[model samples]
Target: MSLDLGRTASPGSTPRAPGRLGVPVTAAEALRYLTDLGLWIDARRSQLSAIDQAALNAPDQGDREALTHDLTVSMALWKAIADRYELLKVAFDSGRVGPTQAEQISTLIWGRLDVTPGQAGEAARSRVPSTADGALAVSLPEACRLSDAMTSSLRARLALEPTAMDVGLRVKSIREGIERIRDQIGLIPPGASRDKANHDLVGLEQRLFGVTERAKRGADVGGYLGPLEVDVAGRERDLIVAAARRVSGERDAATARAKVADLAARGDAIRSLQAQCLRDVTPAPKLGVPDVRALGAVPTDADAVDAFLRRLELVSRALDQAHETYARALAEREELRGLLGALDAQAATSPAITEDERADLAPLHTQLVATLASTPVPLVRARALMAAYQSYLQAVTTNVRGPR
Candidate 1:
């Protein structure tokens, strides 16, 4: 609900341009499709952190490990993002198509507005259309905000993470929210306060997500470096008090202004006093707090919650860094696994593949490399998984496709 829906002007929002067959969208239109991406990500990051904190608090090792998965790279983050875009494209491309459903699905890759609507459907989602002057149509989802499609794709490859349907549902919910907005736009007036009301606030975050840089500097809260989340509860109360003041004429207005000034001054003093008190209060010893440096001991029992989270954080941070290495490894591993799966499927269904690196081309080598370069990792789970999987793939296909 606290989504800071940025105020970026909608780009290339030429109301459904003339695409080949499906939605005729420009590259920039995609940028306007979502908003507050950072806030959404921050929320997810918070969820992950909370999960780690919970695991730390759990009594049993197995329970702790179960909760620990929550601290890992979100299983759905990538796929959810991609699928939302996919659904967005689908809703837009609903009427667009060649002669078959397969052809329509191919258009999912994007780029084909100039293909002369006639030929657009013909090419279908087949050969990705190269724009004039020759360029790839759109860069696949690469930003953070862990999407469902990417994670689903990631899981299918690794076979290590949970394969819950909730992940899929979570993504569908987001896209549905977006689609609902587009559906309702024709009914609502733009810029009305109401336009911003009654929404998940997540959809609006896409506004500046892909186009601008977002950092959680404004949203993130640190224990040692920050006060308890600004309490904003008090700020809200003060604002209400400020708003509730009665002012009829000039004199009443003046009186209200003076009261507000006094309240502000008092609030500032209160904050200063509170800070001073915090600085002076002696923290009770938690095994080592009082004798921290003197006894060469530190707070080891950071409570169960804090201790578990610290471990999760350590592991998560390491995994977040190694995602690229892991992702590339995952892609390669998926390809190998797919190849093997297809070989088995074909071996059962028909004769062997002839004249091909792969034995079964029944699905016919779509061979698209969708790079989830921005995928997130709870590092703890992903690091060991990727290392082990990558090592296994290397042992099997050492001479295969080089690191994607």
Candidate 2:
């Protein structure tokens, strides 16, 4: 929405009076279209997911090729929808604006169609999400808002230029360094080896730097990968790296809490064993020992209740200490729950896993589900938490993409 002061139209360009959307070609209208696309893509994804689940869960006797083909077609449609958004997202990021809303629309449309032949070929291979029932939907009602936005962008006639990739590469390289730093933070006697991690990190950074440099120079760039690379390195002073750190911290916290809980349970079992040992070692109370309550029956006024008071003080203190430990254990469990939320929030900022990448995480996600299902929490809440976390990351990543 920030107006570019440098926009200039060539000679003989017709200046436009504001159109129906209040700007030239309605960018707001364009955005609305994108929103619509998101809705359909999401719905399609959900439908696809259900199909995958059903197929995988059933006896292994389905038409695999046929199913794959059907899903492939669905993926194509989804790519078309996503491409529409990616184009707008790029232009907006590059600060390209036209003199009127119509021009803005024209630029966006042209940009989509203007890909280098090689880029187009690569795009053709990018799969779409497979689905049709619309179980997963993109938020659509708000998509119609592009009309004004396109118009406003056109009014500015902002300049369009290819991004300089060196900066991005340099920034990405630093992230590798930061990752090593993060590993160092935990690599102590009680932790992992930071030096070994750092050694591996150097190689990792070098590879990342080399690849990024190539991408900057127009090598190995293709489809959604280009935009995704931009997202990792193009944002503010590499806040993306900061985000990754948050994710790591969340993961560590969650793991630590889990470990603590396991240790505490073990300690409780051992403590119980120790208590039994003490009982056995006491040799059943000797006949000379006070008969706890029977001492009250003594006829000589020997302050019976006083004898009981001293023993009660010791028992009460011991119970109080145990209660404190139990309370701490409970609090730690709650903290772990909160850490899951934090981790989810951080993961949400991660670039979305494509259908292909989703396959990789499928195992981990499935494991998470099975583990969560066995917990006291309801399946609904566990499932909801993961979905919500995914949605949150998608939104945050989208925002980082910026509007032209």
Candidate 3:
């Protein structure tokens, strides 16, 4: 159930002002406050009764005694408050007191409800207004605040009891949320990402079944309330919230599709680039591209899809580096070829062809021939050959004419 977060009390209603020794001074102030208290208790009597019985059957003597004492005193207070309301009604009907005055008189009993010693007594003393003005001083809104606190306390106590509250409604809420998320994602086709997401969905469904089963088993079936039971409920609640957030109509689905499509296109672009490099570049280098065939699957879970997108991003970077390396190697081969061609042309035009000159050019020519014959010529060796060719051209020029 959703907790109300608005308007705890009626607006502009005055609470009792503190009086001497923190006790209610006027009967009217006490009556109003006690009336609020009585009504709150009436509303939660069934839950409180269940808790009372559970406490009585509790194994821990300390828990049994404490809960019993608190329940007894609270009931007594409620009854006393009820009795005062009746008396005030009678007085007002008989013309013995005005409606306002009679109302205030009933709240006087708030501080007088007998309580046993110890924690329950201390709680009662602190919670029950004592000052004459404070006794009946709470406005309707303040009373609401008090009622809410009481309801919460009762629920907490009930959670510890074997009379396990019907969790069906909560379970229903979670199921509904999950169904909405499922429907939203159903628009997508089957794929690896979707398959992974479906796997997680299956797990959630199993957990839901487990939660439902345990809830069916009475709290007494287990010795007492344990953290595991609470955790199950808590986890289900979290799932409900998560599913609720994930549920979106066509607009959201469109937006999500747009995002996925953008990422997928980028991934495809990298793959295409790698493929082209492999075909066009001599002695193709490995791009280490991930097998993304699974990405074609439609994703059901947002988280799973997000993770897949991240993997695509990493793969893109790797492909980018590999593509760059391939281009650089290809460029270096072209530049080395241009330099060797220039040297060969210069040698053919040399005015003097000495024996030493021919000898010098012969090995250079062999090295260039060997390099051209090989696929994916070694970059370092090609650069060295280009440098040696340049030096040879310079020597030929110096011998033919003179150093410039």
Best by TM-score: 3
User: Can you write out model 2's per-residue Cα lDDT over 170-195, one digit (the tens) per residue?
Assistant: 34434643453444335333324445
List candidate 1 segments past 4 Å from native.
1-24, 34-36, 75-404
| lDDT tens per residue, model 3, 211-276 | 667767753323222333333333333332233324322223445466556655655776676665
**Global lDDT of each model?**
0.32, 0.38, 0.50
Error of 3 at 251 (Å): 9.3
Q: Model 3: which ten-residue window has the lowest total lDDT?
A: 5-14
Q: Report how far off residue 71 is in candidate 2 (Å).
A: 0.4
Q: Top lDDT: which candidate number?
A: 3
**Candidate 2 ranges beyond 4 A from true positions:** 1-24, 58-62, 92-97, 100-104, 107-404
Model 2's alpha-carbon lDDT is: 0.38
lDDT by residue for model 1 (1-404), tens:
12233434321111221244364444334333333333344444444444445557777886555333422323233233335445544443433433453334335423222211122222221222222222212222321211222222222222323344343343343344344334434333345523553242333435323212222344321221111111111122222212211111222334334544544454444444434333332221111011111212222221332333344344334333343333344354345446545544543453322234343332332221111112321223333444443444334344444443
- Per-model clash counts, in order, read 30, 39, 28
Candidate 3 residues lying further than 4 Å off, grouped into runs, are 1-240, 247-283, 338-381, 391-404
What order do you get sorting by lDDT, best first? 3, 2, 1
Structural similarity to truth (TM-score) of each candidate: 0.18, 0.21, 0.33
